[model samples]
Target: MSKISVLIVTYNYGRFLAECIDSVMAQDCGEELEILVVDDGSTDDTPKVVANFPQVNYIRQEHRGVSAARNTALKRATGDYLAFLDADDYWKPEKLRLQMAYLKEHPECKIVFTAYENFLESSVSAQEEWVKRCCQFAEHDIACLPTALFHRSILNQCGLFSEDLERGEDSEWTYQIWLQKIPRAYMEEKLYLRRLHGKNLTGSGAKQCKEQRKQFQKDIVHKSIRAVRRNNMEKNGISVLIPAWNAQKFIVECIESVKKQKFTELPVEIIVVDDGSEDDTAELAKQAGAVVCKAEHRGAAASRNTAITMAQYSWLFFLDADDRLTEGAFEALYAPIQKDGSLSAVFSYARDFYDLPGRSTNAGEEGKVRTYSGCLPGCSLIRKEVFRKVGPFDLQLKTGETVAWQLKFRNTGLPSCRIEYVTLERRIHENNTGRRMRGQEQMDYARILREHLRQKKKGE
Candidate 1:
């Protein structure tokens, strides 16, 4: 048997298949390494392209899903270790050599993954912060599929890929491995380059990809609910609270995004608080089939308070009407709470999605503040119990309300954990509250700083 079996699953990726194969063939690992390419019935010239690579063990099968293709390769693979690469993605020449060295040195580790750079048309960029935020490199479960390498022996125990899942099969498989408490290692190096062209799976199959994301989120939420139940905690259904005011244009998108979360195992009670919108914000929210609550044109601080009062779940996710949740946001948010009984709340990073020039396309870029005062409300997920004890957003303060609350939490010395995952997307548009109330917001922010100083003085 070979030391490592490289499995490449392809479907209509003739354009990039050659480069992927070449990269694998260039690996310098001295041990026996076999390349297995499973062609998933690509109508394109994928078969012809693979035919040129005589060394590759090519197998053509009917159009099965990627999971099935991968499984076929897995069954045929006769190696001690297994590494999968998508046809549109390629590894560095030393990827196998370096990873194998690391794994051999750390034999206790059953799985390992590395960071990767995204190759777009004529330009290369790091994966979006949102993607990185959802999963940290330090943890294998948080790593993306393209960057992972696993031992074949572990597959026997964890089982093969779920053929039923067309998308997010990697996530499901990784999550299962994590649940087994298998030792995992991280290289922290970019070993693979994932192409993000328009014709790629995520871009070409946008709708299907989206549905898969929704299912993934549901799985995470279900797992969290089970964890909570096992601890004998009160089964508080999750309350997804959105604070909206004159957000007619984006309300539907926001609600639809919430409905897509994969955490279907837990009952989700969505509450959209319409803070007296002159526009049809409430109407739009209701049209989207969300439970709407109306309050006199109050700021977001008041809006969140009203929503919490009506919230059935003890945990609260305060999302803006224009923001959205990424694929595993709910799972990431609930994981910390389930692991640590003392954690009062958790916050993740958020990125701007308005497509402004020079703006970071990666998620959670803006929310990566070194200090507590830099944190924003829309980017956070809070526990209702902590919110109740800390008190609701200060209605008196219109601007920097979130910062003010975070400051209070910091002062009280409560455990406020920051999971570097990007769970929320803050849509930046003309109607953003910051742009709308610029002057007043700045003034309120000044007052908040002054109050913080005064409190510090008294404590001193």
Candidate 2:
């Protein structure tokens, strides 16, 4: 048996998986270690991402929740000592080395865990300081799963995770073991890192926390959805298409926001087209419960063309990796298209959340930010058949490709609507490509409009 077997239960943590694995593998004290990753029916490119790591023992199963996934990993683990890590969290190099030493020294101690740090991902408020916060002495007196290392004998005594819960499985399992009166040790040094972002199970109130209440009045827009089974939703479906390239920083919040949309009556599926990101974009997108497709490093328009083929639903809505949809984004768009077969598409007003950026807290006051209305491609939801007529985006044009496609839609003279409800959010960061292409946007958009008018005259 190996000295320690690390059980990592992952649903869709593509972007963080490699770092988590590397953290354990770097344990220099050198006891034999086996790392097992259990992927619970991830629809993203997890299989491909895991293949990049040959050292890990990877097992995949159907779309069970994290509880079942943990139970699956527990059964396959072979080491005498066991440690559990969430895929989105990782350990410091000495984490395994220190915990193992503690377990070895205290024969009476059945479990040992170290203090940890929290790596907060996205912060909206400007006043919030994001320096890494480590779990201090006695901070986590009760053990967190990510920091805990236990003997295999403890498993024989307490049993595996309860497979019933969708959220608090780890807590429930640890609470059960805590009742057994098993001797456990806690180290003061921070040896693990928990990455907290808006997508976390407790996605409420991260924005309005005490960090900002002292400085400025807070406006929070928090909306979330439970990942219920698809069978429970309506037969009419809405598919979200996101084009990603080097979007590891923003994709999680983007996908999580989509999951929380207010259209509970319609089935929603997110499709992320990885536009040849050299970074962890594809893996991260998949881990965030998006279906991922790989494509060559083309421009944004071409990536959308690739996503068109992979979409499973009847209606398609395009989203940029850095942008997000609000809770009721689909409310105005879906029914109009469903009721009027002739309507080619329905578009919504977009709030450009510039001040707070992508991870905005107060949805109500977000309107104070700059908002854009009329024919924004990212805010529009289109019928799939409309694409067959408009054809794929112009390959020759590097920018303003969406404007060119919009021109084609105008050429068809089909019915469409502009709704007053704020359906989507356009995030403005330093890297926003549109911010750099202002002059080109005007020129290309004018050219496309002229071309459409010429086509209209020719048809008449």
Candidate 3:
């Protein structure tokens, strides 16, 4: 039989404590039940009342707020499933039966919630009328914490309730369930009772509480949309594009860095475009387990564009042949996009590293590293759709093709974010494209700026 832990958190509600405990004890479901009544330092006759129920486990703690109380109970719970009930409210006798049946039927659902009815404390006879009014306002359609039954393992994955927010802690916790896309189901039956009274937490300031609740709901919905978008975009995993031109010396290390990400489960494919290298760059890349695509004597811009055409995923990461990704680089750059889907790309800082004077290239690799904060392409995790929106890199620019691409991306008014942490280690040495073609890069920068100005003027 499945075991269920029922948590009842109460604060200064001695009169209603018996009724709440009785309702839980009245559960007809033939499953092992562990009922815990956590008294949040109530001065009332809460202890005396709880003592009357010999089967219930009573624990008291200093009043640290509701979220803290809930977290405390969570730590002590030992069951396969968890269910919560408010001290001021009670559940229907069939609530657990129906919810457990639903879980049994739908094995994929990790959590389930039921509809609830709200009634006033003073007028017990006015419940039917109140239910009707709540229906008209669609207030009885929600699934709150009291009506929720979820697997205990969810806490291990999603984490405990936030203690910082004064209100909307339940909403905040529920938002995480939605963001993670956990399989959930909702029953239509109103199986939970919400006792509305003067002392109700949401009744302190009627107008302000309503506005705050609305704002909280709005934020949850907005965040859920962004999370769903991120999940969809992540379905195909990431395509790491590396454009190499005579970079045989550093190609293996670059490819190895991509392969050894902290999140090794993330589906990643490395595509190295050998841009007409005279050395064994293509052979080395293929030996390093990257899918090598040989191309004519095109610049990095053309090679990148060619790689884009060959890419099979929705997300893209550009890695220069001579650069290396830092520890946990993928997780750091991908987190911002997961939080906010409106971002076109996420960038991390890169550190420029160079060999010491008279150091042998073939010897043990030692270099001096310095922080470089520019939003370079090598440190960016971009969505494939961004390429469609901003178009391909400019083939005309020899050294600053990425500069022109960055300008075009900015012109589209799409948002992007940067993580201050360094995710890329860029090697600064001879044959560095930007260092070798300084004069051409300067002219390209000026041309890119002029083009941007012309476009801005035309739009105005």
Using all chains and alpha carbons, the TM-scores for the candidates as numbered come to 0.50, 0.46, 0.48
Worst 10-residue lDDT window, candidate 2: 219-228
Assess the local accuracy of residue 46 in candidate 3 as a C-alpha lDDT between 0 and 100: 96
Query: Model 3: per-residue lDDT, tens digit, 136-189?
Result: 322521247678999997887779988876767787787677556466655546
Structure candidate 2, residue pairs in collision:
12-287, 219-362, 220-361, 220-362, 220-363, 221-361, 221-362, 221-363, 262-327
Candidate 2 scores a C-alpha RMSD against the true structure in Å of: 21.0
Return the candidate ranking by TM-score, descending.
Answer: 1, 3, 2
- List, in order, the clash count of every candidate structure: 13, 9, 0
Of 2 and 3, the candidate ahead on TM-score is 3
Model 3 scores a C-alpha lDDT of 0.78
- Sort the predicted structures by lDDT, highest score first: 3, 1, 2
**Model 2: residues >4 Å from true position, as ranges?**
1-236, 355-364, 438-443
RMSD of each: 19.7, 21.0, 19.2
Cα error of candidate 1 at position 358, Å: 48
Tens digits of per-residue lDDT, candidate 2, 1-460, equal 2478899888767877887788777887578888899999887767777788898899999988888888888899998888889888888888877767656654767776665777666552222333222122113223566688888998877798766544445544554454454655555467888776555522243333333332211211010011112222112478798988888989998999888777876788888878888999988988899877656677788678767654556678888898777777787777676677677788778777663445553544554577776466567888765775677777656577877787788777778887778777777776777666777667777777787788888999
lDDT per residue for candidate 1 within 254-303, as digits (tens), equals: 88888888885468867887887899998888778787765567678867
